[model samples]
Target: MHSPEIDNMAKLWDLIGDIRLAMFTTRHHNGHLHSRPMTTQNSRADHDTKLWFFMSRHGSPVAELTGEASVNVAYANPGKDTYVSVSGNATVVDDVAKKRQLWSKSAEAWFPGGPTDPDLALVRVDITHAHFWDVHENKLVQLFEMGKAAVTGHPAPKLGRQGEVRMA
Candidate 1:
């Protein structure tokens, strides 16, 4: 069996590799969570981080961020049986240079006018922490815990506490 730390890291790596889309949740002015589907723009292994999207200077999401920067981003891959939720603060970046760097042909499908569109805005969420559950592996772990419980009469391992990390 792998050490807990190694197993957790492997799960996280697998989760990111398997998930291609993420749902971004931001707080509306009235305090309800507003969620929208966002394509996974990029993932940086060095930081164990991922970036989701937005049109640079417009949308209710950008406006909401101006007032409250806290947000939640989630990813799921049913085929891989993995899920992740990241909580962090988002900042609006209008750097033309960054816009140029991240621009791609695929983005044109949504933003017809391209990256130069005046309304295009970027919301960069610097992930502060995250929680993940790998149902594929956790199921086996759960079975083990259940068998142990039947023999020793102890409670099974708690559900949904598979792996997590806090950014420094």
Candidate 2:
């Protein structure tokens, strides 16, 4: 039998495994939330509690992470009706080996100087909690369910699997 923790982690991974980009949100010094699209660097890995990204040291995200470690990364695959939101603490890691390991030729477009570039920054987010929604049925079925619930004056039928996983 699988532990509940393992099941939760597996479910979380199943929701986000194929999504490459996420909206990484952080709080700025002025007390405002900011979000930006970031390509996930470690999604293919088996690790369930950490997410990685390559960024510019001079960017606002790096500065924000320095000020406040709390952050949220959201992943959505509308085609598959899957969405995930992950909360974590973010930190800038100054590990060259890790940078090299996650490095890709496509990254050169942003950091022209490659992994050894002084401006390149590696950010790691230690996931604390994750919430996910995955709809297994087709759109037509979902619409039918909603319509039926509305006509019956009952709560909408559960159209998907939704759960939360605490990792910290």
Candidate 3:
């Protein structure tokens, strides 16, 4: 069993694990933003939150990020009613050793050439800050607060957006 605080942190980690798909958005030179769903190659928590994703070096996203490092990563799990959005700078890494360490069979699906593929690229998102709302408990809390406010003729406090609210 975990303490209340630990339990909450564990829940957040679970939510992130449940949703492996991330919508990565990047800005183009022309000032237009592009968003695409990319398979989360791997997600591990280190001293800092690091998300690894695989993409072709020649892909449009890669080209866009080369010029502009800003990006937004959004994840959603409808069945679990969880969502996470992370905003950070994307850095393109083509280190063969690092790619080998992160490579897996699933990645082979996209990169037939494996980690040695000259076109393979890794984008690492260094999350600065994140916010999350657990609908499971938040919905109940909201109802309770609303009822109390109704009886006391007071307004309920505003809640931030669901998932990781990144301000960068």
Q: Give the root-mean-square deviation of each candidate in angstroms.
A: 5.2, 1.6, 5.4
Point out the higher-scoring one by lDDT: 2 or 3. Answer: 2
Q: Pick by TM-score: which candidate is best? A: 2
* Number of colliding residue pairs in each model: 6, 0, 0
TM-score, candidate 2, is: 0.93
lDDT of 1 by residue, 51-146 (tens): 546554658888889889999989887665668888889888766666666677887787777777777776688776779876654567668878
Give the true-structure RMSD of model 3.
5.4
Q: Per-residue lDDT for 1-168 in model 2, tens only?
A: 998778877777877878879999999999999999998888366457788899999999999988999999999999999999999999999999988888888888999999999999999999889988889999999999899888999988788898898886
Which scores greater on lDDT, model 1 or model 2? 2
Candidate 1 lowest-lDDT run of ten: 43-52
Give lDDT per model, in order: 0.72, 0.90, 0.74
* Candidate 3 lDDT, 45-102, residue by residue in tens: 4213567789999899999988998788878876555677667788998678778888
Give me the candidate number with maximum lDDT.
2
TM-score list, all predictions: 0.74, 0.93, 0.73
